[model samples]
Target chain A: MAESHAHTLDEVRAAKSRALAVFEPLAAVVGVGITRIGDGYGLKVNLREPPPSDTRLPTEVDGVPVRLEVVGQPRKQ
Target chain B: MQLDSARGLKRALIETVLTPFVSVGPQVKILAVPAGPVAGVSPVQPSIAVGIGRKAGHEFQIAVRCQRRELMTGKEVEQIRRKAKNEVDVRYIGPVSKRAAPWTQLRHRPLQIGISTGHVKVTAGTLGAFVRKRGGTDPHILSNNHVLANENRAKTGDAIIQAGTYDGGADPADRIAALAGMARLRKTEPNAVDAAIGKLDDALEFDPRTIRGLGKLAGLGAAFVDEGTEVAKLGRTTGLTRGRVTAFELDNVVVTFDIGPLRFDGQIEIEGADDGPFSRGGDSGSLIVEANTRLAVALLFAGTEAGGENDQGLTYANPLRSVLDALKVDLVAE
Candidate 1:
């Protein structure tokens, strides 16, 4: 992961766009949310489960730090 | 990539990825997930969710929902991932539904589901759900204001009937409940719901657990719905029908009432299969629920009939959250 760095709202949004495009296809991934980490912004990728640290997912996309956040999908009753 | 500006792009991307699987054949029932955070997932990020199901006659059952077999091979799923610009956050779920059962004859006068019921003096409308006042055990009949309160023309203590007037309910023979409260609909004011409730004259005269075709009142859903949420409802005309939420945040809708045309705001819309409608004229007042969880989501009131066709046009509703707040009621759990 990159050390904490200063980021503008515009940069954070750009990161979201770039990250969304990069991760759109992986199955079981649910959503991409914006998050605030320390003084900079981070991207939170929601998934059905926690991905392995060595998975194809990147630690950063478009110069923004990314983190995996497990978000279980709603199931049929 | 402001969230607002990127919304359209994201929606298009998901649509492009799923378009092929949407209608591979008539056996499939698929809809686009709205661009928003998938509910129950943390951090409220933007993403799309797909709801898969099947429609059977008057009922849309979700028992066959999104099985792995229905979705096909892993290669196809991989193809969707690649086409989606590698934006891997797409979410999938099995959305299910239960049909509202038609009302049948019972020897007792206890109010039954799937039968005609409305304001005693007013014509008729479906008694969509049975509810209890917030913090109170007294049961009440929930329906559209137009049905129980005559579009704001009725008063508290007015008589309500099991078989609506159209079904010949009159005087004391069919008395079931009385108008207790109603959420007002305004012409110039922004309105989010069109709901009303009547207090049952006697608890023994009614059974709150059963719906006409739908088995039992499960419970209330805790949140708002995203596009593609599978839902079902029971009404007087249509009996029971199910479909998906096609759109939302509809402000500036002009609906016709007995008095005249009234404008409504912030409504949700549901659409059935291409072959038929999800609701009909007397279906207003039906309650929409998540097919699988049996959780309540919307109140079905107004619908459009496209080009004079007998089938329901498009069904519209108020989010259940707003309805509960406006009416000060809670779902009566069995």
Candidate 2:
């Protein structure tokens, strides 16, 4: 686990925007959010399943880490 | 050994080994017979098994260990077997940890929070909390639209019942409230909350500030909570469970509703603490509160089947402020 350099909330928000723009359009991607990575801020890309190996997901968005998480499809509980 | 003698030995073991630990009080169950075969003991052997069961996440491990060390040793078992003058195998079963039983589905008097409740047309869901119009004194029951309004199908004055229809609640007889209002669910557009309210019946009484297991509500929390914040909820299906904010400001979450697939934006995600689930079916209307402060954080509405670190699944919620604003009510808190 790596911690990002101290970044402002505005900077993280900007990074989230950029990450969502890229990930949200993909069919496997379900959600994108600003989450705590290590002790700092990063973008979490929630996917319905693991993306295809050919699919190129961003490792970082504007220097903020873009961590991928595979959360199953959400249903009204 | 004769069956009668074995029974006597079982009672004696319980008195000597289990009774002294009763003061520990962690929802333990002591059984004389083992449900399964003990490791080194033969199935045909006449064994007086002493089993201790505890619910997961309970703080009684040290006490259980002490009991095991003090009274369940091989020498103790041999001594007991010799005194009984029989080939009795005394086995010590585990302090097995399991989930809490579902008690919220039972019909309650005085309307307890976190019990089963729903619209007459719906199956069941949890009573999230109590709320009132800003500056108004009349209390209202708060829950999800799907719980109290049948996901926009219910009318303004539709009957809301305790224990819900799935749990044997019938309209008119179990009616506790009338559907007052709801934040309608949109088919195509993105939604923020799935909340509704019911006007409390004049004859009914409820504790405004207390949630079933979580105690008193402090007040409203911030609309947006940061990740890693510890939270808890008591619901119809799962009772009280704790978790952590796994993600916040989550966007583009698609939820499957009875109407159709609906899109939601800017939601919060929670993962159960200790690999347990925070919510389940019939738990759709639980209120997520900050663990320490007890401030209302979010209104639970949806969840995933199998994902995240929790073996059960991840839970999603509407920010409490958003739900209150959408419903035009304030939480009735002390």
Candidate 3:
């Protein structure tokens, strides 16, 4: 879900220098980043292409799925 | 009650209110009495006096707040003046008092947020907002860099709008930064810090115009939702969506897709049907803003392969608390 800009003067006044404005509202859930550093040491967000209904995730831009090798004995998450 | 007896009433009032301060012992006492006037009654006015007993060096004091009332007819009116030294903070003891302020019920925990970067052309579904790095006591606007811009270099006053929701303020493409750009994050190659921080240029711009409006500076990150907490957000292609937080502190996420500087997060999920949560394509960079304070919590990142039938609302978010700390900003009002 998305956030809106509907705060009371008192709420906004205190948040005067903190909140960022969002104009667009997409129908689906995308990326949420915690910027620690890449450009700066802070959280950032990113939106990318969605997977096709038939395709699984962890693929390259060309739609090639990835492979992984477990370093240690796998453990439950 | 007698004049001395009235003093007893004042003592009762104070002790009744500060019952939950933990530091205060139960031995505390207060007394209150009536000491005012009634327009249609006798000359004897009615009012309340409060008092507390003190021993040697340790002491106690009482305070009373009054209101106009028509309780009894005044029978006698006389001047009564008494003076006593005070021992504690007493004045509008309603707001912060324990009897007055109670703890809220716990509802929902943190959810994972999936983010995409059009510029980098990579997305990380397992990405999460690391709050511990910034300490638990921070509050500044927070989000992934890709959420703020297609390019990593947004100006300090660049407009950052939540494109995932129906916003009625200045366009997100037209907001200014209070701190420009200064977020720190941990290095992905090793244990590091890499996060973004922006100063809010305008504090009272979005405040509602009403008697009960609270116009203050508020930042994003640490955005949360309760179980069954209905909320929404707007993304690149999806427009606006709705869901609730179902879990928190989900870890051991490994994004298998990579594109040089770009990352394609394939394992994340949001608003799923049965194949995991969340819809896909162009829904990145959206902030999961909560309803009450309208604060941003999850940076719309990725969706899962599961559907609602299999618990589709497993969305991820970069908590706002860590972002606030990196910016050296205050997360809560004192």
Candidate 4:
């Protein structure tokens, strides 16, 4: 993936805002931000652990794709 | 013919004997072994034996007994013999190698960045960079509060040491600076940075703007950049590593501290570029910079062991602008 974006920075920010509003309250979620998805941009949701098998997360937010990453707890290096 | 008669002739012979095998790789060692009864050499004749060995990976010892004899070509061996004008016995011996050591863990005079350093009461951390209070003349050592200030437990005049206590640095002996200031880490509120500085001691000398391998800082980098922007860092534990910005404006990054877990917002996230981790324990306070420009990017403070795609873990850093603004300091760019 590259930093060059198909979507404007504003689009990514708006998408991030929507992702945060939806994912921030979840106990499993740790962080939310904009990330590169293939050749384009998307909202990245960092989870403390994998969500339930039956759990459903949006694949896209406001036309931007959503990528879920299972990043365990971050600690001071 | 006296072997020691001409220094130039001796140097030429040595160069000729070793030149052809230079491309043979670092695993091969050419030494002058004592003349002894060996195949193709007379028992009474003193001969030059070229011993080629293989290196045991990551070990200090070499396996001189190499089963791959074809590594030494007959043409190269003949060239060495022809250069010496004497019988040269070229053979593969047991492996022999020297382990590479990390120099950043050692104490150095005129302290350099990317070395083991921390508060006298703390175990160890990295000396990230050098800076000065805005409009100030004196230089300061920059690092995490957990490093130079013992996580807010230390006072302004507390001693800071190089090589750190965990690396055997002691109070009054390895001391190089005094704590100047820190961006206090709050327990209940979100924090923007985990940084602090130490007023450099008058007696010691230090390079105010250079990193060990990355060269001098060009200047500060943008706090917000694209996710895939490449970056690099030099630190105590990991030495130097390359990584790519995986996430930006990362918020709610909960970092476990000595006091407790604290939430950080608008942080930068990095993932190792080539399957290795970008940073590890004891690497806190490392300065992250643009891989191509060497522009200061961020102050690395936290990381995760797993959950990244590369399996090498993820690193978290505070934007350099936030760190400097919080501490009221500027990079000593000169």
Best by TM-score: 2
Q: What DockQ do the predictions score, one after another?
A: 0.02, 0.43, 0.02, 0.36
- The per-residue C-alpha lDDT of model 3 at residue B247 equals 33
- Residue B122, candidate 2: Cα error in Å is 0.9
Number of the candidate with higher DockQ, 2 or 4:
2
lDDT tens digits by residue: candidate 4, B1-334: 2323223434554466545434444332111111111123222211223432222333121111222465445554555445545323345753344344377777988887788888887767888888999989889999998888877889999998997766668889889999999999999988999999999999688865677777777888876767889998888888889999988888788887777889988888899998888888888988889989889989989888885568888999999999999999998766
The Cα error of candidate 2 at residue B255, in Å, is 0.6
Q: What lDDT does candidate 2 reach at residue B229? A: 94
The segments of candidate 3 whose C-alpha lies over 4 angstroms from its true place after superposition are A1-77, B1-142, B149-179, B182-229, B256-282, B290-297, B305-314, B330-334
What lDDT would candidate 4 get against the real structure? 0.75
Tens-digit lDDT string for candidate 2 (B63-136): 12222533455554555555555344344554444344357877887887788898887778889999998778
Rank the candidate models, highest TM-score first. 2, 4, 1, 3
Task: Report chain A TM-scores, every model.
Answer: 0.73, 0.80, 0.23, 0.79
Pick the winner on DockQ between candidates 1 and 2: 2
Query: Which docking category, incorrect, acceptable, medium or high, applies to candidate 1?
Result: incorrect
- Model 2 local distance difference test score: 0.76
* Candidate 4 wrong stretches, greater than 4 Å: A1-5, A25-27, B1-101
Q: Which residue runs does candidate 2 get wrong by more than 4 Å?
A: A1-4, B1-101
Judging by TM-score, tell me the better candidate of 1 and 3.
1
Worst 10 residues of 3 chain A by lDDT: A68-77
- What is residue B166's positional error in candidate 1, in angstroms? 0.2
